[model samples]
Target chain A: GAGVSQSPRYKVAKRGQDVALRCDPISGHVSLFWYQQALGQGPEFLTYFQNEAQLDKSGLPSDRFFAERPEGSVSTLKIQRTQQEDSAVYLCASSRPPGEKLFFGSGTQLSVL
Target chain B: EDKVVQSPLSLVVHEGDTVTLNCSYEVTNFRSLLWYKQEKKAPTFLFMLTSSGIEKKSGRLSSILDKKELSSILNITATQTGDSAIYLCAAKGYGGATNKLIFGTGTLLAVQP
Candidate 1:
């Protein structure tokens, strides 16, 4: 792809419902990252991946938040039993080795109603 | 814990105004400082500052990092309406080679014509 791609640009989920957000990073990028942005705030790190390995998940807010990059090219963020506090924008970014520059996708705006 | 803080939660300026956005950080395993622009959903990368004193510029946008002060500043010269957005600051930590970022609450810049 020309740039990082994400699906379901907007989502509305009821509390306790499950939602899945997808990201397709630039082809062959060595590093991928997930971030969450609350209203009137900056994007915070959620997780990181190198290749197909999930090296860090320290920023995932709770057990309900889960992310995976099984094949290294595409990734998914799954939220189970979503809560109102989870309503925010989920962003995915990708970069090559050394990881100085990141190209982000359009992001998935999830609104838990 | 790694933390980044941005000042002037919101600013209103005219199209020709020159504004400076401030960011201060305290990262445990600090690597680099970064700037991003957010309009609606996605945050576009702007600058990444690792070394002190050297300023990176792209058109009217320039940024510099002061390692001694543990801070960074983003300067926008002759700002335009298109530049109206939330300017974010993030710090990359050596949590791993993957380079996850800790972001600040961001400074919202509203440029009026």
Candidate 2:
């Protein structure tokens, strides 16, 4: 793909439900990042990956929020027991080695009811 | 904690007007500052400033960084309705092992014809 691609453009889940969002980064990109953007706010870092290595997960809000890039290409973010506060846009970005410029995907908007 | 702050949460301007957005940051081991323009879903990369006092320009958009002041500014000249969007600023920091970005709350620009 010419750019990062994300799945499930919009998701509406009841409170306590589990949801999964997927991201397919640009081919051969070495770095992948996930960010969460609330209404009227900028995107906040969630996690980062260098190839298949989970180099950073400190930004994950809680234990219930998990992300993985097992094969170093496609990634998934799963949220368990979603709360109303979890409603936001989840963005995925990828960058080549050196990671100076990031190409982002159209995010998945999650609304927890 | 690393932090990024953007001023003028919202601004309203008419076509052909000029506007400047401000961003300040406090971070450890700062690597660079980046500007992004966000529309309905995705944020597109604009400029990345590493050296102070040097400005980067693209068409009607331009930005500069000041390391001594730990701040950056984005300037848009002859603004158009198409330029109406949220402008975000992010500071990249190097922790021991991983490089991460801290973003500001963003400045909302509304351009009226």
CAPRI rating of model 1: medium
* Candidate 2 interface RMSD after superposing interface residues: 1.1
RMSD of each: 1.2, 0.9
Q: Which stretches in model 1 have alpha-carbon errors above 4 Å?
A: B95-98
> What is the per-residue lDDT of model 1 for residues B1-113, given as tens digits with 9 covering 90 to 100?
77999999999999999999999999986789999998887889899899999999999999999999999999999999999999989997775555888899999999999
Candidate 1 has an fnat equal to 0.78
After superposition, the stretches of candidate 2 with alpha carbons farther than 4 Å from their true spots are: none
Predicted structure 1: clash tally: 0
Where does candidate 1 clash, by residue pair? none
lDDT, candidate 2, at B82: 99
Model 2, A5-104: lDDT tens per residue? 9999999999999999999999999899999999998898999999999898988999999999999999999999999999999999999988877889
Worst 10 residues of 2 chain B by lDDT: B93-102
